[model samples]
Target: MDQAPLHVLAGALCDREGRVLLAERPAGKHLAGLWEFPGGKREPGETPLVALARELDEELGIALVEAAPLIRVPWRYHERALLLDAWCVTQWRGAPRSLEGQGLRWCLPMQADPATLAPADRAILQALRLPPHYLITPAEVLPAERDFWFERIGHAIEAGERMLQLRLPLWPRESVREFAASLLPLARAHAAQLLLNADIEGARVLGIGVHLTGAQLATLGERPLPLQQIVGASCHDAAQLAQALRLDVDFATLSPVAATASHPQAQPLGWSNFQELAEAAAMPVYALGGMVPAQLAQAQLAGAQGVAGIRGFWSAS
Candidate 1:
C-alpha cells in the first residue's frame, strides 16, 4: 500500500556567487546524514512561507525577509511521504550557521549531482538545471494561411527558442490539436519543447506539457497527473508562489519584473527585487513581463535561470 504523503517546508538559500546552501541531516533523524534543503515540517494552520521563515531562523540562524515563489515537489519516501514546499530566499541577515549542529555545504546547483542527493531532493536538483528563459508567442489568431504561422515558428525555432507556448485562445480544441500536430514536429525536429498553454487536453493528446494560468494555479491541490510531462504555472506573489511550490510543479513563471505594456498596472519588481526572489526560489525562475534577450545575462547574474519574453523574443532576427 502507498503511504500518505507528509507536508514539509524547504528552503534554497544562497550566497552572492550563485552557490546554494545545503544542510547535512544530523545523525539519528530520518534520512540523517543525507544532504537536503534546510527547512522543517509545516505547523498546523501555518503557511509555507511563514513555516520556511521560521525554519530558516531555527536551522540556519538567519532571518529570511522575502522568498521567491517556487514549485512544490511531492514524493513518497519509505515510511513517510513528503510534500516538499520550497522557495528561494535571497534577502537574509547574518551568515548561515548550522544551528542544529548538522553539517553544511555551499555548492553550485549542478555540482550537487543527483547521485549524492537524498531521493526526494534529487528531483529538486533536476529542476534546478533548467534554463530560466521562456518565449511566449502571442495568442491572437494565426493567419488564415496554414503555412504562415509555421514559417514564422520555424524562424523562432532557428533563433534558439527551445521552449514555446502555443496559445490561441479562441481556436477550437480540434483546431489547436491540428495546429500542434503540424507545428510540433517542426519543434521536435529542432530540439525544442512545445508547451500547450492552458490546453490540458491538447497537451496530453499531443504528449506535451501544459502551462497553467494564475487562476488555475490558485485552485490546484494534490496533483496526480502523469509524471512524464512537465507541469508549470504562472505566479504573482508570496501566496500564489507558496501554492505553486507546494504542488511540486516542474516550473513556473513570475512576471512584471519590470513594467510592460502587457500589464501596465502591475508594479514591476525590478532587478533588485528579482534578485531577492531568485535567491530563495527552489525552482529555476524566468523573468517575464518587459524582459528582453539582453537581460538574460543580467538575469543570470541576479540568480535567475533566464528571461522570458513575447515581443522581445519575437522582435527581430
Candidate 2:
C-alpha cells in the first residue's frame, strides 16, 4: 500500500551576511533535537507560499516578504512520506524569534554540520550550496589549443562561473594532471571550485574532487571520498540517479534535456521529463546537454539546481 504524501513548506531564511536560519526540532516531534529548515505542514486550501508565511509567522514571529523556489524534496520515512517544498527567503521583516521554544541558529550553508541535521534536510542543504550555472569543459582540447581554452575558462571564471568540471578524456593522464595543476592557482584566486571528471585517482592525487561517469557511478557501492570532498555523477536515467543517490554523491548531472550537437540523434528528455526525474532525485541535479546559462531559470523551475553544459556554459558572456 502507498502512503499519502504529506505536503510541507519550509524556508531557508537568509540574513545579509548569507547565513541561513535553522531550527532544532523540539521534544515530542518525530525527529527531536535534529536541526531542520524552519516552516511547517501545509493546511488544506493553502498554497505552499501561504503555508510558509503562516508557519513562519506562527513559529518564529516573522513575516515572509520575498522568497523564491529552492527545491522540492520527496522523502519517505519509516512511518510517513513527505514532500518538502523549500523556498529561499531572500527578504523578510522582523527579527526571527523561536516563539515555540525551539533553538535557532544561523550559519553559512557550507558550514552546516550534517550530523545534527535531519536526514530529510540534507538534500536541501546540498541544494543551497550549489550555484545556478555548472560549466563542463569540452571533452577534447587539442594541445595546440590548450592555452586558448585555458584563457577561455579563465575568462568564464572571471565572469562569475563558480563551479567547473574539467572533462578532458582524450588528453593523456599526465597532461590532464599538469593542466589541472596549472589551473588550480587561477581557480583558487577566483574562488571557483574545480572538479575532475571520471578521474578518481587523479582527483585524489590533486586533492580535489571527482565527478563520476555513469559507469563509475554504477560500480561504486559507497561514496568514493569524504563528505567534505565534492562527489558528483553523470546520470542518464532514473536508475543512474538512484545509484548516485545511494552512493551519497554531493550532486549529479542529468543530460539531454534538449537535443545537442554532441548527440543530435539522441532524444532529449525535454523540460517535463527532466522535471519528473529531478523531483524524484534525492540530491541536487544539474540539467546537462544542450543547456545554456540562459535556461537556468527554466531548469530551476523544473526542479534542477542549475544548468550545465560544454558549449553553452563556456560560451556564455
Candidate 3:
C-alpha cells in the first residue's frame, strides 16, 4: 500500500431531529457522484475545523455555530494513506441547500438502506446503530478488588451506565477470565452490555463484545466476532476511523482531542479540529482523551455522541 499521507475532514450535519445530511461528490472530481460527508480537503496552514467551516459555508451557505470533535480514522485507501477526521455540526445559520449541485439526502439508519453509500463509508454507518452514550470500565489490577469494582459498577448501572468494558492490563489469564466471568453476571443482571478490550477470545468465552485497538482494526478478517453482540475499535485518524466504519464496528473511540499524560508529546487535535472530523463520519463517534462527564455538553455540541476516558469516567459512582 502507498504510504503517502492524505488529510481529509468530514462532518455529520444534524438537523432538529438529529438526522444527518450527506452530499454526493460533484462530477469530474475523484470519486465523482460518490456520497460523502459534506466537507473538503485541507490546505497547508489551515486547521481541519477551519477547512470544514469554510467548506460548509461555501457548499451549503450555512454559518456553523457549534461543531465538536468526533471520530478520527487513519487508514489506507486504494494504496494511498488517508487520515479522515469527522465532526458533528449541530448549530448553523441558513437552511442547507446543495449549492454545489450534488444531490443531498438525510440519513437515519433505521429507516435507510445502507447499500447506497460509497463502499468506503459503509463501515461507519454500521457502527452508528450503537447507543450514543458509552460507559468504559475502569482498568483495575487486583483480583481481590472484584467486589470493589462491582460495587461501583452496580451504582453506575443504576445511574444509566449501560455499557461496560474490562481493561486490566497484564493480569493473569485465569484471574482475568474469572473476573470477567464475575462481572458478566452483574452486567447482564442490569441489562447492560459488557465488552472486552482487545480480547476477542475472552469476549467469545465470556459471550460479549470486543473493542479492538487501532492497530488490530486494519487486520480484521471477515469479522470473526458474533453478529449479535457489539464490536468496537479505537481510532485516531480518518483512515483508521474509516476502516472501523467499513468493518461495521458497533461503536468506536477516538482520542487525544487534547494532550494527555498518556502520550504527553503526541500532537493533539483539540476540540475544534475534532468537530471537523466528527461531522464527516457516518458513525456515532465518541470523544475521548482527557475528557470527563462534565465536558459532555461541550463534547456533544461539538458532535460527539459522548465522552470516554480512564481517569475522567472511572469514578462515576
Candidate 4:
C-alpha cells in the first residue's frame, strides 16, 4: 500500500509593496539551504487555515489576519509524498520576522527565480506569478486580419491581460513571428507574456515562450526553452499531465472540461474528472474547453490554476 501524504500548510505573506516573502531553510533541516514559502506540517485535528496560522506564528512571528486560498500542490520526493496547501496572506497583525532562524526576503513574484526555490515551492512561486486566466487567440488565417488581431490583443493587454498564446495554426510561421515581434513592445509595456503555440523557434528567437501540443510534449525529453522563458502544454489525461510534469512544464491546459462546439465529438471531462487529473499534475493546470472568465474562482477551487479558453476569454470587439 502507498503511504499517506503529509499535509503541509504554507503562507504567501505579502507586504504593502506587493512583494511576497520567501524563507531560506535553516541548517540541520531537510532540504536545508533551499528557499521556500514559510510554513509547516499540519498537525492532526487542525484545519488547513488553522495550521497555516499556527505555522506563520511559529516560523514568521505573525498573526494571520486575512488569507485566501492560493494553490494546493501534490508533490513527491522519492518515497516521500506531501500536499503543499498554500494561501495568499494579505493582512497580518505583526510584521513578519524570521523567528525560526531562517533567512527571509521579500520580492515580486515574477522577480523571484524559480530555480532558487525548493522543488515543490517552485509551483507555489509560479502560482503567485501566473494569472488566473490564460487567453488564447482564435484561429484566424489571413494577412488582411493581422492588424485586427493586433488591435484586439492590444485591447486585452490594456485591460490587464497577463498571459496569452498566439495559436494560429493556418498562418505561416514567419508571419506569426513578425506579429509576435510587433506586439512585444506592447506586451512588455504592460508586463504581459506572449507565448507561441507549438512554435519553438519563434519563441526562442523572440525570447518569449512556447506552448507545446500533446504530441510535441510526448516527443521532447527536456524543457525546450531556458528557465527564464515560460513553458505551457496542452494536456487532456493523466498520462499527458505526467508527460508535462516530466518535461518540468510551467503549467498545462487540461481541455474539454465541458462539451463545446469546436470539439462536439469529444467527450467532456466534467469538473469532477478534471479535478482528478489536475490534482495529479505536479504543475499548475488550467481548465480549457467551455471555460469563461466568470468561472476562474470555481476553477481555482477545483485545483486548477485558472481557466484557458479561446472564445469566452476574448472580447468580440
Q: Compared with the true structure, what per-residue lDDT tens digits does model 3 show for residues 1-317?
A: 54556777777787887588888878897778678778776878998889888889988898878887555555556777676676778888898898988889997743445556665454445444445457666555566677877787678777778776777775676676777777777677776777778888888887888889887988985565765667878888888877876777766688888888777987888888888777666566788888877888888788777787776677644
Positional deviation of residue 174's Cα in model 1 after best superposition, in angstroms: 2.4
Instruction: Write down the worst ten-residue block by lDDT for model 2.
Output: 308-317
TM-score of 3: 0.60
What lDDT score is found at residue 153 in candidate 1?
Answer: 75
For residues 238-306, could you state the per-residue lDDT of candidate 1 as single tens digits? 666667667766666777798898689999988888777655555556778888888888877775667
TM-score of each: 0.62, 0.94, 0.60, 0.97
| The best candidate in terms of TM-score | 4
Return the lDDT, model 4, position 263: 90
List the lowest-lDDT window of 10 residues for candidate 1. Answer: 222-231
Error of 3 at 216 (Å): 1.0
lDDT of 4 by residue, 155-221 (tens): 9999888999999977888999999999999999999999999999889989999999989988999
- Colliding residue pairs in candidate 2: none
**Candidate number achieving the greatest lDDT relative to the actual structure:** 4
Write the residue-wise lDDT of candidate 2 on 278-313 in tens digits. Answer: 999978999998888888889888989998888876
